[model samples]
Target: MLQFINPLLHKVIQSISPCVLCGIDRQQHHSLCRDCWQQLPWSKSMVQRQEIDIQVACHYDYPIDRIIQKFKYEQHLHFQNLLAGALLQLRLPKIQAIVPMPISNERLVERGYNQSLVLAKMMAKALNIPIWQPITRLQQHSQKGLSRLERIDNIEQQFQINSTSKLRYRRVLILDDVVTTGSSIYALKQKLEELGCQKIYAACVASAEI
Candidate 1:
């Protein structure tokens, strides 16, 4: 009884406590104060016109980095809600499924969970879209300093389509925590295309560029 009461009492106290990111009274469902949120650099708009339309969650810098680090490394699952809310700001097109990039089994064991998957799940729930886990990883290794051809070559035959027939003609929105050189998502795009997904879009929480 005391243990339960103590935790509840502490939560009540925290409810009124000042926000860590911004010096303001904390509010439910708000991790940082409005000032902090506004200060953080996010894409002015989610949509970026490209061959394949993509939706970006936010720019990868400062406060966003801090949040992602906490969410991924520290296992701060509560950040999912905050991230999902931030993601909703993006004016993404209607998506049939949210596809998360799958990590290798070795990395998954080390991390104990996939951050992209959690982000995708939250986004799917918020958007009322199905979360697709049919994508399977084909290869794993450090991609540093690899040429464009080398990177593409490395991933060839690495990812396998779980069931292209089932997902044929459905729109796929691929989610990733970060994008560098667009290699990772490129591989996913090829795999998704092989699965016969009609319309495919990529969404990354952060990109290496502004």
Candidate 2:
């Protein structure tokens, strides 16, 4: 009789709590349940692209992409919290600052926020780093749906850093929401290098799998 009652007791507890990702019965309210958390598209290692090394938190596929769409397009801002732990879990080198890939003035006005900046700020807070915004983005068309070469062409000469900004360290980290053709970060890498930044590392929330 006691064994039969245990199953009912478990169900009662589960019903009172819900997973952040799936909304299924769970014990923690502010996080994903075990299974849902395991389903995140985690990247196993840092990847080298051209001259810069990039650290990706996860693969940009299926459920991962869906979550990004919700956060960025659907305006589900609270979902950013769902992503906090994973971002906090990422292992990054101690760097001078985390510089978020900036968006053009028009895009910022249209969207009312920069997704990359939000992710960067979350990471900076979690990692105890400062957010750097030395570079400003110029008006440009979206890079979505473009071929690799076209993406490169689209962002050419699109970023400008203030001539007066100065840094105390030689290394810096760049952050962004996504990495597709690697064009955006690569371009920023070149600019940072020109600014006397000896080494540039990058991280993004997700990336397209090869």
Candidate 3:
């Protein structure tokens, strides 16, 4: 009952609320005004990293970068709708579930939430698909000053399969807030493949130059 009412109530609230970005115009596109939404640094294309092609909605620049930073580190969760909206613009593949990038327990404790999961929930609700998390991330460490190969190795060690789950999906999409090296996505993909996911696709709200 709440699930059915929540979306309708949200739409009503959004209809009266001002744009989250500009705070001038009424909310139009995913809580942003039309101009603000149109002004986003849209890429709506694929970027290659770690030999994986990731669909991205915008370039990590200007407001998008700032928005992500705040959303991830500063608890500006209200920006999630806008960020999720960015991802929705992509030409996504047909998938049965959405796999939000997992965060380490340490990061989750420090941040109070996994930012990727927050975005994924919105995406799942919008797309009417279930969220799947068959992999768990171990403690994460800084990759600064590391070589590309070292960074990949470090990230690959963090993901481990959650053996407790018997459920499996063949076609799934991995969702993340940003993609830079794509090492993390690649690592997650490898783990998902081991879990019998035949078709794995990845998408992000933004892609940064690496």
Candidate 4:
């Protein structure tokens, strides 16, 4: 009976944490206020990412853009549930695990968390799938300032698969916060492909069309 209260306590603690999107007492909407809850984007569209099939949940505009800025730069993590809900709009493919694009150690330390990882966990919970952390960033650099070509070039060799990670699954879903040139996700996807990950699907909150 020692662990019986554990679930109760967890539920209580979660109940008290106010909604991040609207700062309300609404617990039913995954810590999002009813207004913000209704604003969720629910569109599934195919993305143009070379030969690999990609899907995006939203158009990367307005409130999502603003909230994503706060979520990343402002260190607001409570929006994870909201972001996860946004990602659920995508038409999921058959995959065993949801893999988040990893951030460099320096970025993780500076941010105190990896936004992609947070989103991945939320996605996994919503999708009823497992989370895999196979992709590792070997370099410590921000992709925001880099141009498309530079991002493509710089991302090369910056990511490598963790040999210890059990990635025997044939299909996997990749998650990212924002996609610009699709370079970073591409890099991680390539590494997974080399490791025998045959079918890959990717999802992101926002995609920049150039």
Q: lDDT rank, highest first?
A: 3, 4, 2, 1
Q: Rate the local accuracy (lDDT) of all candidates.
A: 0.74, 0.76, 0.95, 0.78
> Which structure among the candidates has the greatest lDDT?
3
> Which digits, one per residue and each the tens of the lDDT, describe model 2 over residues 1-210?
999899798667655767757876483523567787777888846776655678877888878788888888778787776555555566877788888888889988888898888877877777788987777889978777978777777786798876777754477888877777678898787777778888788887788854
lDDT of 3 by residue, 111-203 (tens): 999999999999999899999999999999999999999999999999999999899999999999999989999999999999999999999
lDDT of 2: 0.76
* Residue-by-residue lDDT tens digits, candidate 4, 109-208: 8888999889888778777889988778976566677767787778866987788876577889888987766777788888888878888889888775
- Estimate TM-scores for all models: 0.81, 0.82, 0.95, 0.81
Which residue runs does candidate 3 get wrong by more than 4 Å?
Answer: 1-8
Clashes by residue pair, model 3? none
Instruction: Tell me which residue pairs clash in candidate 2.
Output: none
Candidate 1 segments exceeding 4 Å error: 1-20, 28-30, 46-53, 163-169
Candidate with maximal TM-score: 3
- TM-score of predicted structure 1: 0.81
